[model samples]
Target: MAKPLVKRAIRGATVNTGSRRFNLPEREADGDWLDAQGEIDGAPAPLRTSVTVETPRTIITRNSSPDVFFDRSINPYRGCEHGCIYCFARPTHAYHDLSPGLDFESRLFAKPQAAELLRAELRKPGYVVAPIALGTNTDPYQPIERDWRITRAIIEVLAETRHPLTITTKSDRVTRDIDLLSAMAAEGLAGVAMSITSLDPTIAATIEPRAPHPERRLRAVRMLADAGIPVYVSIAPVIPSITDHELEHLVERAAEAGAKSCFFIPVRLPHEVAPLFRAWLDAHFPDRAGKVMAIIQSLRGGRDNDPDFFTRMQGAGPWAELMRTRFRIACRKHGLGNRGAPLRTDLFRPPAGPQGELF
Candidate 1:
């Protein structure tokens, strides 16, 4: 009387489940099965990615976090396809009644009217111009950007108004918008930061299954810098004993490839990220899992994370200090951290429309 439930397995995919709990009272499948078909033809069906559309009334999201560099941001998408196990944004998927684990990667949401809403917001007479940030909440240039193009549309609007913007992403697809970003950079209106976690291709493939290879990201830094766009390389969430070993090498390679600035954040295991990261460690580095978590806890003040405003980004105590010292020395040795130019806001001109056009 009911349709058969089929399960699919995708190579290189990280998350394992298909559905999750919801806030509302609803029926759910229990894990009690008697006898079931395990496989059909000795191979599993391919898991296909799915996307949903969200039309919101506004586009600009402003926050007042002391640790962050930007106050306002725009996320064209609601989930990242990269499937990094340590992503801090993963838990947000729980608000949608989805698993922060698998659904955060396979089930996605896109804002088709993001550019239109941004244009409307910018055209308000009382609006003030500042550098709008992208890829802050969820990466804007994930694989889906090739089809949805919401991020590109938003950039087009910003380019038209000469509005300042900054982007952070792990995908090389950003190079596709070089023409738009370069023109804005020429006027001091745009900049970009690329995240490179590890130089070992094996580690990278296991941790960031769908993200661009580390080398490709390095090449992207060079490409953007060569085109006059200021580029910063981030060695974010330095996993203890996993990715931390490549700290100096990562910064050195990025600097050689044209990065003018660098930033690093020691791993933070907030909320659901902790269990997910533990599972990842058990799967990838079972032998060293306990040691790795112990070191992370030492940096986190005997806990999995430190949520304090000032200490959250950089952590605290001696272990954190060691990372800071290492990062500072490496950055200095590579001739980085001298980029001081700020994105200009004086060049912004609102679109001609009923919201702001001259009478």
Candidate 2:
């Protein structure tokens, strides 16, 4: 029998069969899936339900934009296993003819050449070393990192080159790199930010699915601090009505756990993510979905999302101000404020190589 079509929520794509959802075979397949019309379907049609990991050639990606803080970053993996429903990176999977929902989580990619590519880039002369951010777009320390060790390899390259770097992740697996991170910290070359969405594990499981428990992330903060690395707690994509109540407590706990600073951003639902997030909210938190969206709209200037630069990271309007006020009060109460030292960029050493060379 021909394989059944998988039911998913990708835009404009649907599985009309009411009786069953598609199931993968016991093993993975290498080729793409074709629809009834013989055209390539954007949703992933995995032959097996189990995880498939693949590697790409290049790693270091350079971006010149006004909105983001860092100009360069490296993502060792393509699709994250953490399976956060609100992941903005989900839309990226559509480029590979895959769904931004479940497929984005199960169908994974890693760059085994990441360390080599990073070394090649760093070796280029005149490459002004700035803090290269990891886990900027996707969580580098996601579950697969344990097996692939791609992230660890990338960090090893950075450490050897004395390249200043910053990492943001929600997993305690970051602790595994503590020795390297600690050594770099001594030279003002590294920093880490742990994303803590909610203090409640139940909410975390439903929203983030595969991420580590909240308390484990807090413990990671302590571990990194104990290792002498600067650690910050990021309570990002702060979903109103749901996780908003934990703002004060979250910051308080992170500070208690040795987090040097705390930051947060209101939830963002751009492009295909808006619908995916809505479906998830409806499925898991039906009672609070309406209220949550309303508060999000309030912060977003009456829209589902605001793409404007400064306002995008930090929302606009009264609700945004209220969130800022709460965060400020909490930080002040916990003694985490401007007095905390800023990440050092002065120690950046140009990656050694031929001037203006592009790999």
Best by lDDT: 1
Worst 10 residues of 1 by lDDT: 26-35
Runs off by more than 4 Å, candidate 1: 1-44, 354-359
lDDT of 2 by residue, 1-359 (tens): 45543443322112211111222222222334544324555555432324445555556688987877688899988877787877888777766666666667777777777887787777666677688899988899988889889899988888877788899999999999999999999988889999999989888877786789998999999999999999999899799988889999998998899998988999998766777777677667789889989988888889888888889899998989999999999999999864235456665554555454455
Candidate 2 segments exceeding 4 Å error:
1-57, 338-359
Clashes of each: 0, 3
Distance from true location, Cα of 122 in model 1, Å: 0.4
> Compared to the true structure, candidate 2 yields what TM-score?
0.83
Best by TM-score: 1
What tens digits encode model 1's per-residue C-alpha lDDT throughout 178-245? 99999999999999999999989888878888898999999999999999998999889798889898
TM-score of every model versus the real structure: 0.90, 0.83
Query: Which pairs, if any, clash in model 1?
Result: none
In angstroms, what RMSD does candidate 1 have relative to the true structure? Answer: 4.1
